[model samples]
Target chain A: MINFTILENYFPVINKDIIIGNYTFYIKLYQDKNGYFSLEVDISKKDTKEKHRFVQFLLGLGKDEPNELSCHDSEVPHFKIDYYQREEEAFSATIYFTFRNIAEEELIDYAKGTVVIITKMLRKYFENEDIDIANLSEVVYENSVISELLDYEEKVIDAFYICWKEGDLIVRQKGKDNFVIKTKHNLIKYLNFDYLKPIYLPLKEKIEINEKINSSSQIM
Target chain B: METELDKIQTTITIPLGLKNRIRKLKGSMTYKQYLSKLLRDRNKLAHNESYIEIQNLVRKSAVYSFGYYKVTFTYNEYNNSENFIFDIDIVEIRNKGALESIEKFKKNMLGSEKLQSYQELILTHKLYFELLEKAIQIEIEPLFSHKSRMDDYDAWKKEFESLGLSKKSFDFDVMRKLRTLENQGDAF
Candidate 1:
């Protein structure tokens, strides 16, 4: 009973065959069982095991520039695209556009525009060999670390001042403990080992140590 | 010492049908994991009054075997005369298998979609209740007194007949009732 008139009209008119530079893709747009818009992009070439790498690379690009390819109102990009192996021939990929904000009028434009952008990104990825797939995992890990750090605040540990506030880390000089610098960057920015020497301790031990330091400072 | 304990095995002799049912329900999970999950469900059931009533009633009607762990499950044969005895080592209606089956059914019903229609929600609630009822009948009914057993059957029959559902659609009526209550902001 759901309306598919807009979706049906759009896909056929656009012609499933899409040519982006050297790459040719056969894109089929439809609604999946859960009633979400899904775009299945099949690589024209029979040998797509190599081409699946480009799809992963596109996902990596989306993560890097989330603002461009992010879900409706979310800060993080939609990462539901799955590429499954089809026999011994090729790999087929499906990307779901699960945005609640997408309108009927904008459906065609959104799907087409996204496809074009993604295709262009894939083409660029194929041209460049510098972008390693491993770097994508690293970027994802770094973002998660930043998110986890943002949840808690550590005021003073040892002689250094450290606190995470509003996606920025505020830290003071290690040995000098004089100058305070706040930066909106990865933990690596201050993890140089020169400015700050990071120590590994159990949370219970750290809390006990902090309490002891607080009591000593109060007495002094 | 721990490794030696891990090598210990316990024998469980149950009704062939019940064993088959357990095997089907415990898909992709080991027996220990399934039992552990069931124990969690049983602990959760402590907070639910109606489900506790069903469980308690089954326990009260049955006679416990002394010394060795022997429990009875009555499956009425042909003329509702013969009792099917399940010689299980464990305690209380073999709830581990039953609970895991219920959880599996629930997951399958609510697969991916977060939003469900009134009828769909009702159906899901009813199906789970019926599953529990079936489990009770299979694993605990044999030990039930004739009067007690008839009373339970009549109670379920009256409830279903009130909702205008056939015996085959037993689970559906429960679903509609639960769904209606849930939508009206009543605890289901």
Candidate 2:
């Protein structure tokens, strides 16, 4: 039997929660399973919807910096830290860091140091997510009830979105403030052009309650 | 009359010892043929002829798609480059996304810290050899494959650089972030 000291000693992976700048950062490690085990670190907030998106936006802002990393070493230090960028979902965001390949023996004397350095690097950018979070307020989605935007514009409707399908918001025409609305159940008919305060929490609850009421009456 | 594509001339200098070493292994290949063949097989020597790692700095693309066999290193602007070379089958890691492939290009202009470029060449003494693993695995052809590079290649670069990681800075930020793992180590 092989005596393993660390979790990564057997397999190649490191994942956990890190506390820096008074905020808990959820990070996970993915190592290449093929030749020289390359590693990637993903950082995000926990539980909140912004957890997914919080890191992606922050990384997007720093994509232009000159800190691209890669490792030329082959043994254990065979890893280099590459680039950082955003991984975006429909409503979630995450940021991750890529390293070139690194060997396992590096952990004998260097693994702990490497892990500490990476954490310090993460803390250095604590201000990356320095944007004001808008209170969970009313939101207006003309379609699928999955998204809740913190902010948007009303100058012109550019496109309509559904789960997997989308159409042009409107044809680009000079001096045209009017556009057609397309959807099976569009609130556009019942909505004022200027009043757009409809978010999903209240809307979804209303739908659920109505369905329950209709079912009760039918059973009665 | 020989056509332009038929023959081309270029000068290369090599130590006499290295040349004799290559000649003993060349067998019947002409000097020109040997030089061309040597360039093509330059990557295998890195790890003593087991695998070849192809990393193109220009496109920021990297691939380890060869075994201990006759390999080809074709550098072209378009196309995947080496498709005709037989006796070698390999898989490629598909996460070569660029966070800003041009960061080094910009740094070169801004006159930042000293920049280092990495280059690995492969060379082989023999032409081809059957992989012992192939017979054990009962496989016939090499499959071009891709593995997950990271959570997100581009996103990782952005966060890493935003922390001000230059060779000169030597700040704790670069060290911590680079070495840090999620909730790993004896902590767990």
Candidate 3:
């Protein structure tokens, strides 16, 4: 096997979240062969109508410098939303969620956390009514996805974050104009999130959720 | 006239290995100086009988349709000189049915507005080999011819300069030629 440790070393630690309507939901990271590092959240049939509404909420988190957001409904049973940044290089995060067994309220509550919100949106899109949540057992990570993430991580370290002053704000409110709004949001902004440093989080805690899923699989 | 020329030029049958060694040794020498030295060496050790001459070297571009090879010579050269020439030929290899499928491919390709020039195609195929041979001849031949003058950097520099070539200029010329060639096909 080709040693992909070099590639895996560069992936930014994505702390993902999902939101359905008003609530945040759970999600799982899946590496796809087409160089997509996807977050999937599985929900139930009742929350199907809120799929577009949930995606709109994600769009509201808005964009940070160097990040572009786009949505596609080109696939059946799932809506694919992609967030990408292209400059001298590119970084992208795609969320695939399928609406399954979970409620819309639970998904909305889950969206309070960044990781949970992203996960809930993905779960609602990727899961089909025919697919059993219990049967989706295999966790496969593509080598290309791992390599791409590693490349993105290196670029993130090398690039200086673009800082914007209040003068650059597009919205000029007459009363609150003086307030210096320096906002960094989205995947690019999350590069600064404190939980990302692998050294701070012990390996045991890092694998906590993954281990739980694995153990639960064994019990089933 | 041919009989008189044959009588004047003595047939020298040197071993292939010896000839190769001499060729390698004469690598840093000028062609004139190398030939002179080789003549002297041949006269001193001229006892061999069997002689083999490489009359010609031809490079052909062959188009295979289905299973048959339809070959046509693209380039040919004949060498009647005493010394053997070692010019490397590099050819591009395609699939067996490439020519037969060309009409279909051309139809698809012509739909695109951009077309490649013939000069560009030829240069892209030939430039590396040309550079390699020229560099080897200029740099290596003189040193082989004169062992005593091995450290003569000035001589090597003069030869290199005399070639009147630069990597940048060569690349530019190739691109320019390619552009001209590409335009020719469209005009016709």
Candidate 4:
């Protein structure tokens, strides 16, 4: 592995993410506490809540495949970097790759291949997207708040819940509704938003918090 | 006499195709009710998604300030369920200096207008998180990974032995483990 400082100086400060198919590729580029620059990437599956099993299969954790010599021989070689699964969630698992201590020249080359491989594999296994490396390039240096809200919108889909002063709001999912907040606060009540009308802001327009405050009618 | 029937009595015309389409929709609700449901559902869907995002953030905790109050969420993300469980602490600015800052923050929020929007946003986020967390109780890699297809792990050694790859890769411990796995049929 070589070290690349130019790619490390700025951009992709951990919060840049792009959603492709049922997976969101979150890229975090940062300098560690000791000022060691590292690039980390994680692919989270939004559909399948699989974890270790997925990682084990991916890392070739334990196996003597028919022709492969070392377990690392099965993976890493083709992608040009070593990786393992980190941060396993119920419906998602983060495929983590650390591009630490890599030269700028080699890092760029390695990153391009990596992006290509990820695009190809996601298309191969999931077949839910027509995305390519170009789709990934835009994920660099996005506005954090919009990205956060957008990420929230993408992940949450349509499943919502509210707990303001108990019986304040509701989300409309079919079948039984489970809006129970465990706190013993007596004033809290759970109600569905379907019955309680509220605006769907994103479906209309994006809300920039700073802009909302600065340009609101009251401020005028 | 103005009766309930008078309130209900109204005539509206719809194209035959739309009327048929509405009739084909499978539910006991009337077309009017269903259309109204769709309209309301747009909002629910937006709120629900924000809600889901907050619940997902249970991987760690989140704190948001609304000037008058600040809500801190500490999540127990160790469970595998639809419900996300968390303890919430609402902190108020009681100190005189902090109270002034809170007032300044509230003023900057642009009084009622921004307050309403922020209120809806947080309410929606909290509502969705609560719903998804309602509960609660509670990989890997790569292109070359194509070769490591997990399904083969249970029996790959037998296949490898037959294929005559490299016995060196399968050490004594690994071989025994593989044999045990082979006999157990993935009991682990």
What candidate 1 keeps of the native contacts, as a fraction, is: 0.00
Model 3: residues >4 Å from true position, as ranges? A1-220, B1-73, B77-98, B101-188
| Candidate 4 whole-model C-alpha lDDT, 0 to 1 | 0.32
lDDT of 4 at A21: 54
List, residue by residue over A122-206, the lDDT tens digit for candidate 3: 3333352233333222111223333333333222111111112111212212233322223433222332322222211322232
lDDT per residue for candidate 4 within A30-101, as digits (tens), equals 433333333434444433453222221121011112233322222121211112222333222111112222
Worst 10 residues of 4 chain B by lDDT: B137-146
Give the TM-score (0 to 1) of chain B in model 4. 0.20
In order of appearance, the predictions have TM-scores of 0.22, 0.23, 0.16, 0.24
Poorest stretch of ten by lDDT in candidate 4 chain A? A55-64
Clashes counted in candidate 4 amount to 28
TM-score of chain A of 3: 0.22
Docking class of 4: incorrect
TM-score of candidate 3 to 2 decimals: 0.16
TM-score of chain A of each: 0.27, 0.26, 0.22, 0.27
| Candidate number that wins on lDDT, 2 or 3 | 3
What is each candidate's DockQ, to 2 decimals?
A: 0.02, 0.02, 0.01, 0.02
lDDT of every predicted structure (CA atoms): 0.32, 0.27, 0.29, 0.32
